[model samples]
Target: MERFWKPLLHFGYQQAMSCLFPVIIFVSLAITKVIDVPHLPDYDLLFIICLATQYVMYRSGMESKDELKVICLFHLIGIALEVYKVHHGSWSYPQDGWTKLFGVPLYSGFMYASVASYLCQAWRRLDVTLVGWPKPVWTVPLGAAIYLNFMTHHYVYDIRWVLTALLFIIFFRTVVTYKVLSVTRRMPLAVSFFLIGWFIWLAENIATYLGAWQYPNQREAWTAVSWGKLSSWFLLVIVSFIIVAQLKHVKERREEVPFRASRDSGQEAKRQA
Candidate 1:
């Protein structure tokens, strides 16, 4: 029992740490919903809090500079998606803020950034590695298609189910290896993606309850988000994972190049001697 519980506790601790950014965002959302501040609308206040939290995370070395860059990229990507979704009547901010673009609040991007932050933090904390990762030829195009489908589906055919089928086919053999304390664990990459997506769905419910955003059905009165959205989040998680994995792969290759060069130079000198 002691042996089993020890690793479980460590796993929980790491997960909680990885969730720091997300936890902060949710707390801000809840607080802003209840509290009133002079000259600061709730949405703008949430934005300021998010910005400060990001700066502190960087300054205190909670997140590396490269990870921060990834978060920023996701922030912009999320904002673009939000603007499109709002325009198409998918959802609405339903609040006024100077930081809002079109109808979506600027702070909403941080919600997406928190997802990237969690992925980066968990990857580091768990010492995660991939087995049988698909080549970029397969992954890059799939990722691009998934993102584009989010917007195009509104106008053209909704190919989300097709893309999801492709996701399983592409990642079928992939396994994610992660460490929990001294123990290492393995999970199928597809299963991990589903699990993360499900949890994000759960978090979305909480966020909506806290007045983060509202669907058409939720505008008049709060109600559960549609189960159909789970598939959307599942595919979105894959997109985030692919982007981070590609960056990590590129960084590893760049680091290997210098090492290989030095090794070859040493071998040449040995032959000369």
Candidate 2:
């Protein structure tokens, strides 16, 4: 029973962390729509939700100060992309409020913050570690290029496929080692990116269904978001991974000499298994 319950509890925690933002969106939308606060804007409602979400996180001690800083940075980064994407006609917020920044509602940033929160929570909870982390020379530039391509593709040719190939080259052999219960599990880093991206895409559909943002095609009628966005989310996963990597570096530095040495030795022993 102890062995069975350990993995179950870990899984429950992971799901809770991953669903935190989406659940907030879902419940907030339901409540706001059901109750009438005359003149309370959707954007403002979302802002309150964001604050409440952060407060709950801190009070629960689920996120540390360093993790909060990373989450806030991701919020800003996400907003920058939102501003550009909304301006470029990639997507539109079909609502109005004082919280709007050049057309994007500030609450939009929390969506990205949620991603950071999820990664941070999972890392700590799962005792996650990386093997074969590519050097910054390769990863930093690749992350920058992937982010830049999202904006530049409007004027320049879309190099997403090329970037995707480069991402594979960098991470295909890299493995993510995470523990669940008494056992450790490993998977290729790239595969985790795709799995995460697919889930985010699913969550995006729910967010849109709740009217968080509307793609051009979605403006007239609600439909499933384009499957192509999976690729975009996959690249965004890389960006999220990079940010988490940097944060983890601070934690890793204290443990790397002993930890990595053992982890690497273990990898070698298991190479035949």
Candidate 3:
């Protein structure tokens, strides 16, 4: 019983801490309708939430300087996609505010930052390591291709399925090793991708339900996001992971314990000879 509860408590705590930003935003938005802040725009309120969230993370040491950099990078990437998507009618922000950037609320980027925050937090909390992770030569180009497809797919042939297949090729052999309490466990990288994507999809539903953004069909009324979006989120998860990996986690083979020291020993012997 202690063994089971220990791991469960660890998982629950990490998940809750990682979700801090999104929950704050969601609750703030829900309350905005009931409480009137005189002359405050909804988008501005969201902007404030974004700022407050970052401040909280920084002050509480929830995010390190490097992690903050990664989160900012995610925000930039997310905003770039948001600009294009909003312009192309992929989605729309119905409310107006001074902080709008080419029709996207400044706070929209926080959504992506939240993902980065979760990745960074989970890595530290779970003591995660990547085994059999593909070489950077393999993952870097694949990540770029995935990001490109998100843009080109709008005008050209949608090659998302092709990219998805390549993701499996690159990552199928990869395992994510993590510790929970006293136990060490491992899971396939692809499984983690799908699971995170599914949870993000669930979160997306809640965000839309909170009026974070509206799809064309949703302009009239709220509806469930399409199931097909799971695939997109799956792909996006890879993109997020690649960026976080490049900046922080996603250890290579040589970075693992015994091998890391062995390689150093071999190098010393070579130098002596």
Question: Using lDDT as the measure, which candidate wins?
Answer: 1
What's the CA error at residue 161 for candidate 2, in Å?
0.6
Order of models, best TM-score first: 1, 3, 2
Please give each candidate's TM-score.
Answer: 0.98, 0.88, 0.89
Tens-digit per-residue lDDT, 8-35, candidate 1: 8999999999999999999998898888
Q: Indicate whether candidate 2 or candidate 3 has the larger TM-score.
A: 3
lDDT of 3 by residue, 1-273 (tens): 987787888889877877787778778778876776779888898889789889878888988887888889999999999999999999999987899999999999999888888898888878888889787899999999988888898889999999988998889899999887757899999999999999999989988888889999899889999999899899999999988887663444336777878899999999999
Over 4 Å off, model 1: none
Poorest stretch of ten by lDDT in candidate 3: 246-255
Task: State the local distance difference test value for candidate 1.
Answer: 0.95
lDDT of 3: 0.87
| Residue pairs whose backbone atoms clash in candidate 3 | none
C-alpha lDDT score of every prediction, in listed order: 0.95, 0.86, 0.87
Instruction: Tell me which of candidates 1 and 3 scores higher on lDDT.
Output: 1
